[model samples]
Target: IPILMGLFAAGGTIYGMAEESLPFYTLLVPVMMAARFDPVVAAATVLLGAGIGTLGSTINPFATVIAANAAGIPFTDGILLRLAILAIGWLICVAYVMRYARKVRADQSQSIVYDQYESNKKHFLGDHDETQTLAFTTTRKVILGIFAAAFAVMIYGVSSLGWWMAEISAVFLGAAIIIGLIARMSEEEITTSFIDGARDLLGVALIIGIARGIVVIMDKGMITDTILNSAEGMVTGLSSFVFINVMYWLEVLLSFLVPSSSGLAVLTMPIMAPLADFANVGRELVVTAYQSASGVVNLVTPTSGVVMGGLAIARVPYVKWIKWVAPLLGILTIMIMVMLSVGVML
Candidate 1:
């Protein structure tokens, strides 16, 4: 289940769910407790999995699409590079989580959140059955098939038809209805389930909204351009390679203030894209840097509602979460820096 959840969270990263970790965390926390593993393991599986996933987003509308469009480049221009980054990220995240899971499973005291895990077990694990495996029924198999088909349709629609988020969301809505029908849920049950799901995810929505508020404040203050202008002067006269690396780190810093990928694209890409031309760097490289850097920072930035809110749900203190995730984050950053250097050469 941890492995499956990690894969699922990785997919969520592709969709750019930096501030939306609660739903996955909710599903994982209980299972981890029931398995007698640490809650930190559950949190790490979802949080870091999604974090690394976002860093590797190839076709994410929020990150790649907006940044590409802002740079006046075709979104498909950086596909191969982004896919390579994603593949590397996915491998690292899976290995890290698996290694940590083994440690905690063998001895729960090694977990940073061991005390909290013990206290919370009663609340989260009372009804769970660690020994019982789910029996797959005909209806369950049909539901799984529909779920997989929905993803195929989404990929085809986005890659071939250029469908946007609205259309992708519609596909999910249609699939949800079909799944409900196949499960033999009554109309009332469907409605109730939908509400319950939404209610459970209310914190995620609130966090995203609050995070956006920071961007709103910066825009109104008229300091956003000042920061951009300042950044431009600092990068002037650097070699293309150095310039792109600086831009990557710049995006990492700016992402702290503006957690929204689309917002950052709209704010920085216009300025950074034109500047890239003067530095003898490709606009595609600029976009890649923005998406990659911002995605990495999202893992730990306080401005990101996703990180803070996810930690809140997992009962993880901000300091402890940092201590637990920092080593892996550093490794991921070094790997990305190498990839960006390669991208500059390309």
Candidate 2:
């Protein structure tokens, strides 16, 4: 109530992030324990943030709700389909990423001198800290506690309340009450942190603006119609498995532009509904394809506002994330498509 009225926007191509406090900060904060420049930690951070964000994004307006409605399904009814799609996407992503990360380590052969997770575990068991020892004062503990509690509450708020306004609002309010007393912060100083924090998000805000542009442009151009039309033509006389493959490939390519689950479904439904009926493919199966492609494509797309937003928030450059994540995404996409083919045949 004190700040923004709500957290998520209905159709933002980019800035429309969800309100989960736990997952959002969890992905980035692991960095504090990593070596200042460790690539493993960086990769892990990218994976966690983008993965959780997408999973949660299922309920997100653009990613799931709006498109579901447009797809001729009730908004809440698509939740199961979205979950199935997200699971398949994550499975492929994690399997390939683990290998890609190993290759990065194998190729570089650098010592895991500052593995953040390992370091944190050690610290919990009485390991000696070098540089950060002096920095981990009572104030830091209080601030961390505040952040943690705020995150916990906000996570609940997201699953229940379904808006970013409450979560973000909670953060500022918690920070003032907790960090303020611990640091004996003046009202001026606490207010300053809020300003600085919001300012830090300018880059993410910009990316959101661009994502909106892409959705609007693609939608205005009627791209989805062309995609579904092509799918219909390709599978006109194909067998069950081939038909599934045709639609799968179509989605893999379309996902590059229509990363939002809802957007893709909206673009797909008018065409897919008739095609599914014609082919005797169940509506649920067609939904499976939509969900699967939606998850896998965004993981690698440079246009993905969520992925880009994570990088921006972490102060990581876009090219760096893309460079490391591309190979992983490629392998994952292939695996997901192949698996979905098997499922469709069954």
Candidate 3:
């Protein structure tokens, strides 16, 4: 459990790595069930791991670069601060998951899905003999090397080579083919697997579309700016400390209404940036507050495709997720508040 959580936490550190959370949730759910855990643990693991990385994203282009650009600040400014956020957030997530995992492992009745354990085991474990020892063949080792090498290349590409989603996608496609071939999968088998995987995730795609459509409605209604303008007016004459906290919570509230980090950046930065000057807060702090608040909110917001879609895949209801995640979310919120307050002082 520690090793698994640590691996997922590391995955969160890289900028675009957390995008795999939805798919990883699907894969991890069965594995958790097979290991005598509730599927909710798998679902929570996905969001907490990826979401914390995003909340503390120091260098992720999607979360940090666009936000910095929108605020007209140097992208590298406050990087240390962001890294601090990442470190603290990652530790909190690991601790939370570890504590819950220990409880569930000690007593299966403690699991939310205890009633479904028998049926879940039947479905996920199948007829495979648990006692059989499988050999790690030379071919399998080579395949593992290929898999690791692909991600190493991807990390280098993104960190140093200015690669974005398109380049990363191409690399993944190439890696998929190489891995499949090395695993002795036939062409038809590869195609079938891809289709099946996509089919299972089709709802996630649709949910994302629907979430974006909500943004479209707000955009067409022409009320996004009004909300921003009203927010600015309401916060006028606040001191720097109060202003930063208000801005952080305002971003949290807006996250429910906007949800998309980049979209919120484009919408709020122009107003928030200049407002930061009047409020005597650094524009960098404003961007920090925006990204931190939005990223944290994504873990629980119903409007977030990642949140709802992942919950759906895990078969965990939205209310149940909120109940499970609320305590952790509260801890994270307090952490973000401290980070922002400190950012304002610095």
Candidate 4:
């Protein structure tokens, strides 16, 4: 599931796949709970899987491409470096989540959310029948095939055909109808099921709206620009090594205020990219620092609709998520600092 999240996200340019990932929480939370893992595991799988991929974005237009362009470099200028970071970061994230998952599966008492285990199980698995074994009938198999194909087509369309949410939503809607037809469901059943599913995710939708509202408020107040201007002053006249690391941390702070990757890139890269020359580092390194910091912060930023919405859908508490992800966040932070320091010297 983490790998799938990475693949799906790595292909697209939609705010690090934060909104794109909300539906999967509804799908994966129940499965993870049934498999004796906590909702945190499911939430982390999607968030970090996609987060790390975006952090080390190579071809991601919003992150890597836009930052590179604003920095006056080709998007492919540091492609190999970004790919290496993505590969390493993905492995680290998968291992961290797997370790927690295995511990939770081995003993439910070990789950970080063990206190809410019963309630979470009930909330996520209430519709499921534990006693009834599902038959792998041909109809079921075909439905699964269509489900997989929907995602495959979505990925292809986004990567190659420039498809966005409208196009991708149409693909899923069409696939859902086909699946309903294959299952021989009546029109009323289809509509009811669709409405129920949407109702179930309504809270997540609202959280996303509220989060975006906050971004809009910040923009209207010019708070993001103020923060960016302040950051510009702090990085001037530092040594190359110190300069790159400080730039990364500054970007991290800005990512919270401006969670949109493309927005941040356009705002900061133009101002910060040329400063890299004074620091004696490549502008591409500035692009890398900016994107990597944004990627890392988005993993946990409350300002991000993706992070909050995914947790809401997974039924994971925000505080509990912070407790669970802090260690991994620290590790990634150190790794990124080291990578940026190395890039400075290189």
> Which candidate leads the pack in lDDT?
4
Sort every candidate by lDDT, greatest first. 4, 3, 1, 2
Off by over 4 Å in 1: 1-6, 9-14, 18-21, 127-212
Instruction: For residues 112-156, write the lDDT of model 1, one tens digit per residue.
Output: 887776567865666656678788998899998998788778766
C-alpha TM-scores of all predictions: 0.77, 0.69, 0.84, 0.93
Q: In terms of TM-score, which candidate is stronger, 2 or 4?
A: 4
What's the C-alpha lDDT at position 244 in model 4?
90
lDDT of each: 0.78, 0.55, 0.79, 0.84
| Candidate 3 similarity to native, TM-score | 0.84
Candidate 2 per-residue lDDT over residues 163-263, each given as its tens digit: 47655676657656677778887888878876876686776779867976887787789875666667668767666666666776777788887776666
Worst 10 residues of 3 by lDDT: 12-21
What's the ranking of the predictions by TM-score, best on top? 4, 3, 1, 2
Candidate 4 yields a Cα-based lDDT of 0.84
- Measured by TM-score, the strongest candidate is 4
**TM-score (C-alpha) between model 4 and the true structure:** 0.93
Query: Compared to the true structure, candidate 1 yields what TM-score?
Result: 0.77
Worst 10 residues of 4 by lDDT: 8-17
As for TM-score, the candidate ahead, 2 or 3, is 3
